[model samples]
Target chain A: MIDFKQEQDGAVLYVDDEQNNINSFRSTFRKEFKVYSAINAVEALKNLKSYPDIKVIISDQRMPDVTGVEFFEKIRHIYPNKVRVILTGYSDIKAVIDAINKGQVYRYIDKPWNNDLVRLAIQDAMDLFDTRKNLSDKNESLQSAYNELDKFVYSVSHDLRSPLMSILGIANLAEVDVQDPKSLEYFQTIKGMVDKLDGYIHQIIDHYKGSQGKQFGDRIDFNKVVDEIIESIKYHPSAQGVKFQVNLEQSDSFLSNKMNVKTILSNLISNAFKYQREEETNKFVEVTGTITSEKAEIIVKDNGVGIKEDKKEEVFNMFYRAKQDETGTGLGLFIVSEAIEKLAGSIDLRSTFGKGTEIKLILPGTSE
Target chain B: MSDKLSIVIVDDNEIDLMIGERLLSRVDQSIALTKFNHSTEMLNWLQREDENSFTTNTIFLVDIYMPIFNGYYVAEQITQVFDAFDKKAIIYLVSATIEISDNRKLMLNSRVEGYIGKPVTVSLFKELIKKHG
Candidate 1:
């Protein structure tokens, strides 16, 4: 019912074995953009070679001798950046899935394609292809940067740790003779500073390691991971006098990365512990998980210094801290936000300023 | 000479070298585990030891995070020597923090025997011995 004219700047190729399909596509899309049609995969390949500017290819699945998936898989090696879409029937769902999993098809439209939706999907595919190409170039640069940084870390740690350890070792040896209060106090302060620097180095290593994998995902456990986190934070100085509550409604297993989920939880929990009221107020943290047909949800609620409603969105931004005295890298929440997005998830924040805050993460689950 | 496994580990960290020796000793107490806190000494020793003079079962466990000669460099050298001297030797890399995927790819790409994560517990060393034996 909806009308869509091809707004693709470059020429679009419609490859189908049916002659009627070629006519239908041309009539529907020729108003706003140039359309190219091929009755078979051979002609499509020829057209691809002839027209270098063809940015998108919409191919039908049920072609003679070769299916859309096979055709695109062959084309992918040659025109690696070309946007590919499959027009398949409802009966060919399994083949469509195979095409997607093999990375041949970008999107699949049912045989009775919605005219507007098909056009829009094709346009979106082109835009996505361009974005992926740019991202690939960026990834290459990041790879070099990662290697250089790793080498730098190894060198710096090797050069610095030895001298620092020797200095500290000699200082401890000398401490046996010194009995002055001020001298000992000064040595203690220097030792503290050195330890702090070492801790920062470890943090840098962890951050570098965490940022290395940009690939989307794998299977992740929610329950056992949550248990480990609770155990890790139970003895923290800030968590004193705070009761922890946990509730889970999912099958302890899910298909996602455990590290990304852990990152999100750790950030939220750290913030919760950091901003707790110092008075005789009842302090507690409640973590709950629920899985529905659509998505998995995690709610982290803490009785802490909640942000103002207006500042909730800004908190997720990098290096944006509400308190000037808060000693944090500020990259923690930013990394959390990035991880959530990479998983195709959304985060919602609710807070009552000066009372409490709650963060909810809704992530796509395995059911789809 | 066949009764004891004479192994040499090259790493800059005294703790890591000590730990490696301790772990390897658990596998075979008769094992003559020598530790080198410098890579140049390691490469020099390997060069001087002739194939017939040294035991064929000798292994070189090298750390990848050293200052001068890294595990990759040591691996390349050993492979070259194996070809030139017509001696068969195994090189295993150890590192604390390298990703498993990256380490696997590097080992496969460079034609090395294996890699073990650092803080190498005693059990892992035993497994290595069992597999290599």
Candidate 2:
């Protein structure tokens, strides 16, 4: 959607008190650029306003009404983006210093200037202008594309869930009516598959929401948020018989996007529930959250099945599931990492295979 | 008979309508049920009723996405009609959308009492009945 590589033939404006100098400058660079000649500062200002695309503004230092530095300084606010150059035969050090400091002149060429040198300087200015414009245009289009993708992800996931819900609901209704042991088992299988599909859909939605970028603020209640997340996960099938301990310490009010924190916490907590070692009788997940004036720190530790030493680094990669478990979407930790990065934070994970895992996250307490 | 709560369900999708009807019946069989495939038809039915005819407690569960008039517009029209006759009714918005920001503006309207995501279930329907029925 962006044309960053396309070449641009930018315009140049020459301002001078003498018509002969303006004519000669135009004749020398007319083929390379579209040249506009102005007889004085008044006319130059008018042209600058009318033609905003004029990339270079070259003016003679000596003029009847105003010096080149004065003219450049005057138009700095009006056409700040334009590249400015001064032409003067008189070696006035004050004028040169003023032009450099106040006027923000890019370069200065002596009167009876070398045509080749002036031409090169103008070319360089145009290139710089084109590069800046191209970068900004590309950024705008990229931002818009991301926005569209977010909307598409939301709608598609939402629509997909509709039919899946219908299937699940119908199965649920049928399960209630079925009496035969074999038939009931069949219905239970259907319910299991539907629930798995529903979980996958929810993960997809959460992945998109996590990547939507920078939806954080100053009003966050960590205690209440943790309570809600624990409540929801406690009801899940995988969380059966798993114990949770939450400890929150905050002397100052925490400020960040509550949703992002919720996502990160929920994913980590859910993973703790999902990957528990079945044989291990003592299974527990501990979360400690501390908030200071500058930062909010959270550490989630789970005593269950842990990641292999070789797969530690790759765990954060998108769709990189370490285990062959059918329930793992591999997007859970990836979303966690993304949300942390967006919050201008960092995450450190330590784990011992077959023992336990602990994840530490430190995020900015205030919006940057 | 007039004391029974009336439930009005509107959805363009046939399968969704059938599933919703089944779910509502599963929740409470005695609820007087009315179904509409089009939001315009639903609006018209409400507008055509006599001024004092709204005696029983009524609840509307309208899908947010539809062809002609959306659930938001239907909710606004219902609010106006009911307000003119000094009546009270509950309106709930239903959508399959996971994007919370999409329906945020509609959710702000005073006429809308709640928002429900699909597919409609007996438990959710039972909760709705207990809260509004």
Candidate 3:
């Protein structure tokens, strides 16, 4: 249901070889629209070039120099947004088909056209044109906003890390010269605080980068990815003494964004290592991945402290932590969820309170 | 082979320079340590030194983020001088920033031997010296 009255304000161009037909068209729709009349295709092109606001172009099929379809095809690239309509005196089904396929005409008008039908067609065309313009403008603004945010994140993180690094450096130097045990303990505490801050800053950087949704399609080797992540995180104090079992079943490589997969695995594995029961001696984390032609599935199961059933739903939300773990920033799972969503994946959690937790993820084999 | 090791550290932050000096001194008390808060000053000093001064094994730790001349530029300049002087210089890029892309770009350069994250620890310093010394 188009607002015909509002759409009537849009400019319409009428191209006809006969002066009488052009005059009659102008006389009929002149009150309803800002009508611009052209006696031939050449004149119509000139009018189109001069008036950028013309939303619709109506041309007669049988013309002296060129047919209406030919004119529409020629100007389609230049004025793509302008909706085209065909007018003919005969039934010419072949010409109408050609017009629809080649010229992309909105509608074909018969010789004795109903004024109301033609007005409705023009209104619809104008509405479509306005909708397209609004969408494109919105997309442009959103892209610019995203780019600004990216630059802001990059610069802000760099500035914040600069002074923090200086503090860490000074602390490191001081630690070496201090002989008193208490003073050394204080320096160690300072170092720990700085390391925690550094970890938080890294998470912020990762979150911003992951949210950009820029996908880099590359061949994924799950074995290599899991091994690298384990190697990197194995040295963390929290990961100490936790046995890791990796089983990659897919022999063939899959295609996906490597960074996204890395982030997902890193966050999940780190969490699996972090939320362990101190009293449990048989602590083990198992990562298993399988890829078929259609999709890839990864399952991470840990025999450690598990999540409470009631609070499981809230774990994916930003800054949502189940326990009073000061070291956990609550951003890890949120970032993991975002990465999975961007990859067109779904995650399911199965956990028994004080027993264990297991997460299974299914992702599309290829990105859209 | 009796030539002692020479260490040159260029960073814009005064605190970082002091830290680096202390760290290097702790690594080896007798090793020659030169610290510059500005890249241009380091470049000027290097230019003034005689050719024989670079005959000894030397290591340069350049901070990537600076006001004018960045670590990449300094590393490139050092490589150029090394090529002219026909000597090998081990140039390591150090930065507090966590931008992996920037670090990757720096590592791709043939002149850059390695990239170290900021707040250099004693163990890291010892490992680098042993591996590259």
Candidate 4:
């Protein structure tokens, strides 16, 4: 008896008014399923409460006190995940529909139960229960893993920036006391390298903060975010003679991830400002966007050193630089692409060799 | 106020302390500067301070991250010792990579003037000198 019960695939509760029927169900399917027998509605509730592992329930439709559909409906809220099946000899279509709608029944068994058919139904129900349980369990672990990665990335990037800052500080001091042109140039070269590394670390931090779902739902004010980024870039050397223009049409209620949007816009705008031609009068980056209830469309256009047609495809790849220069870390567009993926959005780029570059992005947002 | 300001620099890292000294010296060669690599030592020095040592023109630059007592603890101890002085020295919090928590603490502590991210630039040092030097 213990061996047969141990071989069972899943636990199920059988509810019927007849003692004879309960005895028969227990005898026939006891080998295949771990059957829990309950004679009346009250006992059925007791069995369900006692055996939390009860996944599928088979209850007779007609009873002395209550109907099977009624019993299933009563405990629907308490045992919401349980797979319910109604059994009855009298075929009542209305009752079966009601059972399916309110009681959330999985299947209907005829008045005279078939041993073979009932066994298959119970097996199928157990399979569905396992699937649902696994899915929810997987979701929890996935979320926690993402959170762990986010914190790890943030701390590591900040740690990397400390030493880089020291080198930068050391460079600043070296620049003042060193009189020779050769040594000054060497310090300038070292400073440039440190600056690039520092910028790369910043991108990593931004990417991690932007990806985590827990960081979402920050109301994005395009004009305000743009204003802040532009204000900051104005102090950088790349802002020289670059006219920054922002034109956004968005309502007050548009909701989206603020950090991702900032990452996307700043990288795009910074790229435009950094790669401009020597002709001072023609340098300008025009940022235009419109936010709707379902999506946001943005265009960043700049008259800068445009990407060559061959290099355009690889521009979004990590560490792929179109221009071999000391100004950029080659991570601006790569970070933008990562943020886009996190937002589940899309981006398009167009550029000519020496004329300019234009980038368009479509991002999802909600007015609520 | 005196013609030359007295600057106090505190950081646990030896290289950072040296760099701070050089940076502040380059800003104004005549300015009197003091450096401390430990927060406890700095606190002990404050305890030994007399009326003439604490002046209105005195400036303190404290590193935020350290070994035993972090920069905020140092700031708290300094406030306890010097908040009532007639010539209160202005304190500025400095960090290699500024953290968000540091910003919140800076806002809460009105004693801290502002946060400066390292490596500190010559222009930034010159700006501080122009303000209170």
Cα lDDT tens digits, model 1, A1-368, are 11233565677789999898888888877886667889999999989998887788999999887999889989898998899999998899998898899888899998788998887887798788779878999999999987898788765554555445444543443354468988888787776566555544544555555565554344566666778877876786677888788887876456665567677777777678777877736898888988653568989998888899898888888878788755565666787888787668999999998889998989885531
Error of 4 at A187 (Å): 2.0
lDDT for each residue of candidate 2 in A36-144, tens digit (9 for 90 to 100): 8799998988888777768898989889999888888888887777888888885765687677876479888877899888988888888777777888899999999
Q: In model 3, which runs have C-alpha deviations exceeding 4 angstroms?
A: A1-10, A91-93, A214-218, A255-257, A295-297, A341-348, A362-364, B1-5, B30-58, B102-104
Please identify model 2 stretches exceeding 4 Å from their true place.
Answer: A1-8, A41-53, A60-82, A86-114, A176-184, A215-221, A253-259, A279-282, A294-297, A308-314, A320-326, A340-355, A362-368, B2-4, B52-55, B102-104
Error of 1 at A59 (Å): 24
- After the best TM-score superposition of candidate 2, give how far the Cα of residue A219 lies from its true spot, in angstroms: 5.4
Q: Give the per-residue lDDT of model 4 (tens digit) for A1-368.
A: 11145465668899999999988888888777788978899998988878777889999888899988888889888887788888877567578887687637888888688887898888888888888788889999999997888678756655677788888888889999899999999999999898777777777677666665455577887888889899889999989777778899986456778888898999998888888888657689999989875788999999888999988889999888867764677777888998898888999999987999999999988444
- Candidate 2 clashing pairs? A216-A257
Which candidate achieves the best TM-score against the true structure? 3
Q: How does chain B score by TM in each prediction?
A: 0.83, 0.88, 0.89, 0.89
The local lDDT score (0 to 100) that residue A348 gets in candidate 4 is 94
Residues B16-67, candidate 4, lDDT per residue (tens digit)?
7888888877777777788899988998898898757765677788888888
Q: Per-residue CA lDDT of candidate 3, range A119-152, in tens?
A: 8888888888899888989999999998898788
Ranked by lDDT, top first = 3, 4, 2, 1
Checking candidate 3 for backbone clashes, the offending pairs are: none
- Top candidate by lDDT: 3
Itemize residue pairs with steric clashes in candidate 4.
Answer: A88-A111, A89-A111
Q: What is the descending DockQ order?
A: 3, 2, 4, 1
Question: What lDDT is reached at residue A252 by model 3?
Answer: 62
lDDT of 2 by residue, B26-115 (tens): 677888788999988888898899766664567888898888898888888888887876556788888877655756767667878878
